[model samples]
Target chain A: MDIKSLKNYLYWLYCQFELITCSYLMEPWEKLLFYTFNITMLVMVLYTAYIFVPVHISTAFQFFLHLLGNQHENTVSVVK
Target chain B: MANPSAVCNGHLHHHHQKQNNLLKSGIYKKNGITKGMKKNGVSNGTLHKKTITEHFEQAPMYVAVLTFLGFGVGTIFGYLRDFMRAWGLEKRNVAAEREQQKDFVPLYQDFENFYTRNLYMRIRDNWNRPICSVPGPQFDLMERVTDDYNWTFRFTGRTIKNVINMGSYNYLGFAETDVNALKTVTIELQKYGTGICSTRQEMGSLDKHVELEKLVAKFLGVEDAMVFGMGFATNSMNIPALVGKGCLILSDELNHTSLVLGARLSGATIRIFKHNNMQSLEKLLRDAIIYGQPRSRRAWRKILILVEGIYSMEGSIVRLPEIVFLKKKYKAYLYLDEAHSIGAVGATGRGVVEYFGMSPDDVDVLMGTFTKSFGAAGGYIAGKKDLVDFLRTHSHSAVYATSMCPPVAEQIIRAMKCLMGLDGTTQGLQRVRQLGKNTRYFRRRLHEMGFIIYGNDDSPVVPLLLYMPGKIGAFARRMLEKNIGVVVVGFPATPITESRARFCVSAAHTREMLDTVLNALDELGDFLHLKYSRYSKSSHPELYEETRLELED
Candidate 1:
């Protein structure tokens, strides 16, 4: 193939790889596993938040983080 | 370094090795591959070996995904199970709280039922009939015939106007009208509001209240006075606040309910004397003086001798001179309740003490109520300034409750002013003497008519005895038909056997009204088949002769 055609072919292959990876990540099984890991990590983070930080500072930080994390997770799940 | 075909050939060799191993093993026997194996020449087939990673990659992707999915589902279920257990514990705690609340319901219900069903029922059933139920149809027939003449109907709008109001302690016509005094009350009401919202200790104390106290003290011949919301509170607060665990109260058996309630609350040992019996009072005083000795070095203090100035039910005046002598001899403090005698008895409406010409200081404490003479409400206790000061500070009823209404205090002040010569001393004293004369005339006339009169000869309260309970309602109805108003007294308030009709003679009544009332009573006696002949001196001889002949036979 000519040099331009070869460059076009390489770009097409990159797009195909992206599509395959996205479809696999968006599957119901993959989503369920992701959510379970996310919730477990959140529980551990909350427990650590109470122990390592002063109550007032931790409470304010926890509320902001929980709101941001919940919004991101909901939007991602809905789009999928 | 390797060719494509060589690498493909190496992968095929490995796959063939794995197939050979499967065929050589138990797969051939389990599958029963005798015909298929012979056709394919299974013995000559090569087998291939695969690596662990390569074998895992060959497995379905769903199997690996399902394993992680199962672990996630199991974790969520475990959390849900723990949450359900906590919810169950909370529900049990709520149920236990509800059970604890259920225990108090029956006790509250029982108290409500007792007042509603039992006490109120008895009051409703005996509304108009004398407190004592009359036997037979005689009372009913009299009531039916005398509907128009029923004075109780006119007064209370009740048909059963049978009760002889002997139970009422209103001995004087004070509860009745003194026209000039009432007119003054209307004038005072225009100036003062109806009630005082704050307690006596607060800003509610009015000038009229202070004036009433002064008037009451002067009327009773004392140095100072303090008012109470009720006669009951007057006795309950004054008695207990003065006497302590160290003191003894010598009370009369026939003392009013307020006195009894006060003595009980005083925390003092109570020594009761026989009704109107001076000997018994002396005996109690001696016993208390001896028994009240402290085991320690403390000497016994003086005792309090409590008595009513007038016995309400018996209508007997207290033997004031004798009581005063006993009180002085024993060195005991005397407390007298002149509830019935204030506006009705004595030479100048000064009650039992004035009747005997005794000084107010002779009695340590003098308590009286305005409900009787002033024709209003409230009570007062008169004593030395120190005792009044102590009571004003220490009495719980005074400290806690709303003060007496300003208008009621104003009315009492005006009434006392009228009694104490706002008009003139001559007119006031004249009215007082007229009341005494009327009481005597009414009592003598009733006694002469063969009516068994209860109470002392000087008392304005004339109780006509009807020995038979069955005749009580009939007698009251017949008297009402004659345009005469009288009250019937019966059981619970008095002994059923002593049922009678009580007539309260007022100073407002004229001689003509008295004469008319007597004539009507004579007619009532005839209508009821009651005998007036027994009262006649001329008919007595015949009655005696008839008894003598029966004895001879």
Candidate 2:
């Protein structure tokens, strides 16, 4: 998932291997199915990030506020 | 303080003379004369050039991967924090942030300070650490502590003493004034107080300023030179004076920010070539000549090539010989900035020109700063008399900015005299030789330790790559805790994965001192998993054996 290994992997795919299955072996219907699956998966990940992050962040914020309520001045100089 | 070093310098000078005689006679194959100054000397008239910069090696794949992953995770966390603040789930302590402006648009964007709050805050203490002594080989850093996740810091009333200063650009040890230079500086102080409070172009050109300029011209082997008050302004102001409207500036992409600002302000059409890549430069030069200016199709008013003697961040020396050839072929003007390399480079310390065994006339403009190697406050431009004459009236630094301080000028004069052997001693030679030796030894040791470092092996700015952003702060903190000062850079200044800690090796560093710092680095490397190199320099295969599976494999 890191940039460099991904680059090397792509370089290997582009230089050493031929795109046989996707370019030649796949039928029109299968190709359409593959494209649909990829598009849907990417959209789903983006959608989850859009919807779930706010809730997770609000909970974390509430916890932080609760944790720092009473001894705000002392904790301000002592801890995070 | 000075006598022992003078004695050491005398011994080294004699040894150098004996080796020089042998080298000329072809008795020896050039081994110990100087590590990085080998084969290229003013005595020899040719430069041995390299295609790609050799010493700046790439790190192992894992370091890059880990760095990106850290940044990605950090970015996601940053977004989450931003969302929390924007949606009012988390409230800022500031009263203004809590106030709502009814029937009006919000004045501030919530994510405006996202990078600062989310990313930089986590590791902000690594930089801008205040030091309380002369930034020589050893200095004192005032310690401070932070609470509430680096939102603010308060001084702890403690100073870290005897901290080995590997972070400063005091290359020739000029920042540390010895007894001899101190006496002369005091005399100059009485004569000229601190500063003249006027511009050189107005009334501030004193005897000391004139003498310093003449000495600088002689030291650089140029016809004339002009002094300026500030180093950054030396380029940012003077470049506009030289080139403007429709002029083409073929600048290196890795050129300094000052140079970038100067080029932009010049109102010139700037074309960038890959750093030190002669092929890319040649392609640009050819296209520029063929294409000429935009729309109208006339030739550019002038083609000026801008490059630095040694790029400070990358620690790479300019391919000056090759660049000169390209300049001559394209009939372009050459502007060389030796800010970091002036008194620190070359066999005779004349800079990149002397290092390449090329004549001063090979370069059209010779620009450098006294702030680095000279350990003074200003900069200078030296070339032909015409260039200096034109810059005298036209350059903003010369015309508007106040003249350089008198004592600073005297310091530069004394330092330049020592560099040119006018002080009737070889201490300058010894310093240059020591710096070259220190640089090579330091780089060789880092390479042997399996740490990836950038720049020429001879260049004093040794950037040791830490790669991981997390390790950037970790390395600096650990080194400080071990009583060593280091400078680390991440993100904005460099590509995220190329985060590094740059060690500016100086002639002032003793072998024992360097070894102590190296020992600290070795322990840190082991703990931090920083040994990322697959190759080792000549020896230390055993060191590589320990990190092989953990790193490259």
Candidate 3:
């Protein structure tokens, strides 16, 4: 909903992929690494939701509009 | 003070005090700010849980809607990114095509455009899908099973149960997995570990390599033999050592590409004669010996006549006796490439020399490979003891490249022993006989059906002419749909107009299998209008007249 929550979600997704990749690697401590990652992800998601939701929603709307406009311009030029 | 704002300020002050303690411990940095109040002053664990529960309950519908929107928008953006990449690639390809058209020959430009836009891309896109995995006789292939008019490709899982194999080079069926030669290989692998880890001149030569070389020399009836780690390199790398700038080479016009490379690499003056034409070969040899060379008029230090025991493309066996007579008459050393003929043609599989009743000693240098007939991997140079010793020291392949692995060498030795009847069994003799019989039978059957086939009747590599360009792909696909794996060659591999499907007969195939293939081919022949019988109107007067009358109407 908000910029902070979105940022937290993206970071969580990045960490999830990292955990998956680490699991694929031939590491002895992969299970331990995944356990630590799961605990940290829960704390981050809740903390960001509690403190930063309202302020970020407004800022996130502006950033989203800017991103859409930039991509539209890029697609037009590339097509030409 | 009894003010409403006073209560809010008091709660905020308490939260700020707790935040200060947490911030001092280096937490809540990426979350921007943690200046907020919870309903109660609880422990950190309880507080964290309370925050999560409160946030979710506060706006359940809002969270769900935003979550869905995030996923939807992310997917759309990802697809747009891929689309943009593809659009850029098309533009680049178009520009490249325009530049190529301007710079290249028209035929080459046309070929480039066709491959880039059509054939090559289709091959790359469907590379893994259409081609069967573990390619061999009776391989596992994907079959389209129709269920209630809706069709889907399904893996049969059972080695294409009854599929006829006309694709592999397993001529005597020696390459089949169930051969006893593999037992020796397994034992050799355990003894020698996997590879020798060095060139033959170094420490790569094991006792197996020496034993195999001796076995090859004994089998070919030569004084000595030297084996190479690779078949292609055996010819390509060894030619330079045998011939040099002062020498001249008379090669067959239709010799294999590896032979061509070896001749070119030698830097010798190369002359190509009409394929298997004894008169053309004699003329080239006589001219080289009498006139010396065209430009320099310098006497050629030596003359080498290069020919294959069997021409792979045309499936024609070489006129070895005539060629040998010319080689003797002109004083040119003969180089016979027996890559396909070895373990295939003769009664005991001694190759074309034996097939023609000529002695192996008559040829100066015999070049053959174990890849085809021996069901192993490697090649050899069999000749006089002095020549073999010379090549061992001078040949780049022997000196620089790693020697053949022990297991492969052992397998080749076993195959040769079996062929020589040293294994005390007639299985190898039986396979050789069966292959010869199958080849003639299949070729005769094709002739009887009125389909045009190329190559000697006894040659296993038979190419049935498709002639039409579009039919190359169509014929192959149709045959595959009928569960036959066939090798088709077009354009660059063969003459542009002479596209054909090459069928190799293996000893593994039975008479019944060959009969089934003939039946399937007859149906395909009529459907594709490929049969000469269809074209021969006199033979089928009624059908021809009906077609002619229909055309007139």
Best DockQ among the predictions, by candidate number: 2
lDDT of 3 by residue, A1-80 (tens): 78998996777565434322322111234335555766799899989987798779878987897677755677678878
Q: DockQ for all models, in order?
A: 0.00, 0.01, 0.01
Question: What interface RMSD do all candidates show, one decimal each?
Answer: 48.2, 18.0, 22.0
DockQ of 3: 0.01
Candidate 3 clashes: the total is: 0
How far in Å is the alpha carbon of B526 misplaced in model 3?
1.2
Query: Which portions of model 2 show Cα errors greater than 4 Å?
Result: A1-80, B1-53, B88-113, B536-553
lDDT measured at residue B120 in model 3 versus the true structure, 0 to 100: 29
In the predicted model 3, the residue pairs found to clash are none
Q: For model 1, what is the alpha-carbon lDDT of residue B51?
A: 13
TM-score of 3: 0.65
- C-alpha local distance difference test of each model: 0.59, 0.78, 0.69
Which rank order by lDDT, best down to worst?
2, 3, 1
Per-residue lDDT tens digits for candidate 1, residues B1-553, read 1221132231222222223333353543454433443344532232211111100011234423433343344334334433554477322211122446775654433433332232222222223434223221112212332232221233233354332232234433344344664675666677776777777787767887787777676666556788876777888777888787877788888788889989999888787998778899988777666666546534456588889877666667777667777888878899999887776766667677666544566688888887775656778888777778887888765787677777678667765655555543444455566667767777666656666566677766666654333244456545655545456665445553455566666565666666777787776654443332234544323343453364355
* Per-residue alpha-carbon lDDT of candidate 2 for residues B1-553, written as tens digits (9 for 90 to 100): 1332243343323224333432252432344334324443323334463333456677767556656766665566567666777688875533233355744665544543565576677678888999998898988999999865566789999999999999988999988847766788889999889998899878888999999998787666567898887999999999999999999999999899999999999999999999999999999999999999989889998999999999888999999988988999989999999999897877767787766656676789999999998788889999888889999989988878889999989989888877766777887887888898788778878888888888887789998887766677678888999999999987777776788899999999987899999999998887676777877355554443443344333
Off by over 4 Å in 3: A1-80, B1-136, B142-162, B179-181, B533-553
Q: Provide the clash count, candidate 1.
A: 17
Off by over 4 Å in 1: A1-80, B1-183, B293-302, B523-553
